[model samples]
Target: MTDCGCDKAKAELEEYLHNELCSTDAEDIREHLAGCVDCESELHVGRVLTEAVQRACRETAPGDLRDQVLLKIRTIQATH
Candidate 1:
């Protein structure tokens, strides 16, 4: 339980876990997470969500949709 309750920090922490922040800002968030259990749990959930997304992506390539997108891109390139 932080003095301010860590809600804003948790939001920034999710971005930090995703590596979406600049280096210095990410380091600041990492340091905050190190000392805060609440923030750390939020960071862990973000990591788990990311891993799940990667696993799901690997399992399904959507070949038919991919081919359609590629064909559309080729047609646009040919036109331009």
Candidate 2:
């Protein structure tokens, strides 16, 4: 298996992180990352940022804010 090189690996890193790449492409990235410290570090950073974003997405709005937004939506719907 040839190393897919840093350019392709970095370009597809996000897709690889999200498991959106086909197996062949993912494998190429995996192999490249295995031998390349810079790409591996980049992958680590991507993992961290993804995790942070996931955590942020999982958080709910404060109760009062949620209620206010819902009320506004309902009012707009009522008028329309």
Candidate 3:
């Protein structure tokens, strides 16, 4: 398999990390990452950032804050 090069790999790194790429494209990125330290480091950073964001997204707001936000939304909806 040919290396997809740094540009394509970097551009699609997010999609690769998220398993959003099709098999062939993903394979190309995989091949590129295997041989390129820079792109691999970039992929690692993307993975860490993605994991952090996912963890943050999984966290729930405090009940009081959630209630306040819901109340504000209802007030706005009522006015509209």
lDDT: which candidate is best?
Answer: 2
Which pairs of residues have clashing backbones in candidate 2? none
By the TM-score metric, which is better: model 1 or model 3?
3
RMSD of 3: 1.7
Using lDDT as the yardstick, the better of models 1 and 2 is 2
Best by TM-score: 3
Give me the runs in candidate 1 sitting further than 4 Å from their true place. Answer: 1-5, 61-80
Candidate 3 per-residue lDDT, tens place, 3-68, comes to 789999999999999899999999999999999999999999999999999999999999999999
The per-residue C-alpha lDDT of model 3 at residue 38 equals 97
Every model's TM-score: 0.61, 0.81, 0.82
Candidate 1, residues 12-68, lDDT tens digits: the string is 766776688887777777677778887888878888998998898889558999899
Expressed as tens digits, the lDDT of each residue in 3-64 for candidate 2 is 79999999999999999999999999999999999999999999999999999999999999
- List candidate 3 segments past 4 Å from native: 75-80
Clashing pairs in 1: none
Query: If the candidates were sorted by their lDDT against the true structure, best first, what order would they fall in?
Result: 2, 3, 1
